[model samples]
Target: MTLAPVEYAVIEFGDSTVTGDLVPALTELVETGLVHVIDLVFLSKDADGTVTVLELDDLPEGTAAAFAGLEHDIDDLVNETDLQVEAELLSPGTSAVVIVWENLWAQRFSDAVLASGGVLLDSQKVPQDVAAAALAAHLASLD
Candidate 1:
């Protein structure tokens, strides 16, 4: 079988302004056959300088209800050690959402490449703002 492409993202938000919609959004992705969420983790730094970590199973009752449709086993691809490294960058009283997702939409393409004897290459995501700027530059150059 061709290997599935995986991607990870870490998103940070101020504690007072945070509203987590990841579970519902991920559910939509899974239902749409776009991506499969392999891992979901929440990290928070309190004002008292203490850090908190939780996986899907550890979420609060009210919050856990939102993730009822998760399709994969709740696991961590970005483990504790990796989370600690990232936690150091968070400001006090801030929170972050970490997710690892497989590109379900690309499996067919990956299989085709493998069938043609082509090796998989590195893949990376372009930050949205940077991609927008790039598109603007290309459009300007075409004028």
Candidate 2:
């Protein structure tokens, strides 16, 4: 069967701490367009290593290959820069990022994300109205 296109989002929060309502947000995203909910990734890093795990209903079609490249790019940027970020993707269509702050690394991260055919939705860096719309749109999908 033809799978839905993956939509990704990287919500970069200013707090740098994990937030709740992720599931709800993702639900909204799927309900918006005709896209399927693919893999959801949480991009966090600590002393141990980087955390880039999926958190959505429909897992990405080509997760292994997509994530391999994503992992490499994420590692390189994190090691060379300071970006507390989180990434979430909705299969072939969209992705969002939440970052502590905006910096040059944003471009690099954006490139990596787009390369994977993901959109970079930096909630922290983006306008409040836009975020609200996204959140609202995502939430409305619950119905």
Q: What is the C-alpha lDDT of each candidate?
A: 0.77, 0.39
Badly placed stretches (over 4 Å) of model 1 are 1-3, 16-18, 141-143
lDDT of 2 at 43: 43
Candidate with the greatest TM-score versus the true structure: 1
TM-scores of the candidates in the order shown: 0.81, 0.30
| Runs with alpha carbons beyond 4 Å of true place in candidate 2 | 31-33, 45-143
lDDT of 1 by residue, 70-98 (tens): 76554767888999988888889998877
Instruction: Tell how far residue 74 is off in model 1, in angstroms.
Output: 5.2
Model 2's alpha-carbon lDDT is 0.39
Return the TM-score for candidate 1, rounded to 2 decimals.
Answer: 0.81
